[model samples]
Target: MSSMLKASVQIDARGARFGALITAIVFSVALVTQSPALIMWQAAVFAIGAFRGPQFTPYAVIFRSVVKPRLKSNPIFEDVRPPKFAQAVGLVFTIIALIGSLLGSSVVFSVAVAAALAAAFLNFAFNYCLGCQFYLLGVRLVSPRNSKITLEVK
Candidate 1:
């Protein structure tokens, strides 16, 4: 095959995880308090993250501008796409939760919020992103032989 490259934006893993942590906390609070307002705020964040890169999210912006200055470790970069995909997943769940809340169906809202919290917590605590895994699985299944994708930090 001819040489071809697909460049991907490299994201700082630490920053992304920090955002995940914030997301987890937000989701946790939303679930606990059953606050539709908070959930709406989170959904906006997820929408921004999904449409833009995770690096562009407000949480990530905070990490980059504030928390990052205190850390001594080198920045770790990763593909930008996966996080975006994860945000989309989060958005989906968040929308479901919102729908449930608006419809006065506590069960649907609780379940959806809990699921989102679990995913965000897993990513933050274990550095394991569930949505990213799904994306990777899809990629593997669709393009087992495709090696043209290359990562480049912007």
Candidate 2:
């Protein structure tokens, strides 16, 4: 990958890390209220994590911040998919939520809370990004580019 792209990833990941922090704060408050506001804020956080915006925002932030630039320059590391792993986490969490919702288990909500906290913690501390990995492996399976062992970003 180009230096510019690697730099971009770092910047974005840093920003995303901050954003995740904000989301964590918001989530903590919302949990007490069980308010609709929580859902809105959570959606915003996911949006930041999932899409490119006016700024590098969420996903890019994870990419940019979690890994070193020199490491990012390596072809193997450059294509590593954090987003895809995040997606998988979300999907698995959602499935649990769905089942719990169907069964009317209040514990499902609690489980979800734990999962979200884990994800944010993983992002903040370990730099283990699941979202990018999820996008790369789960969503892009049909793409020709993803079919290859090596990814060509350009």
Candidate 3:
């Protein structure tokens, strides 16, 4: 791993789930109200999480400073890269949704936001990080050649 990846901070998995839950809820509200502003706000939140890491995102910050401390159980810390990558993916979708909304294409906007919302819902409800899995698959595909790894046996 590169120093930059290694240097990434550790974050509580619970906090991450909390952030995802908050995102899902926000997206749900935005969809119901057909609020472009709310979608833009979500995009901003995802951008912050992608660029500054989860610790600096509003939901994570609130979870860390407020909810985590009040919890009775200890937090489980995990590598931050996966969630960061996920947030980047979310940012892309949200930006698409925002642009679509601004352009007055309800179909485009709804599709993009709905996809992101589904991913967030999965993460929140099942602790399944679709973005994280994609990140891992991407790393495996892009990594340097290996001697033994193969899809078929000779």
TM-score to true structure, per model:
0.84, 0.47, 0.83
Global local distance difference test of model 1: 0.89
Give each model's whole-structure lDDT.
0.89, 0.51, 0.88
lDDT of each residue in 57-89, candidate 2, tens digit only: 443454555644635343323332354335335
| TM-score: model 1 vs. ground truth | 0.84
Most lDDT-accurate candidate? 1
Model 1 agreement with the true structure over 11-69: per-residue lDDT tens digits: 99999899999999998889889999999999999999999788888998899889999
Pick by TM-score: 1 or 3, better one = 1
Worst 10 residues of 1 by lDDT: 145-154
Which residue pairs overlap in candidate 3's backbone? none
Q: What's the distance in Å from true for residue 46, model 1? A: 0.7
Predicted candidate 3 versus true structure: per-residue lDDT over 1-154, tens digit per residue? 5987568578888998999999999999988888889999988999999998977899988997889889998888888877888899999999999889889999988899899999999988998877657876877889986656574554
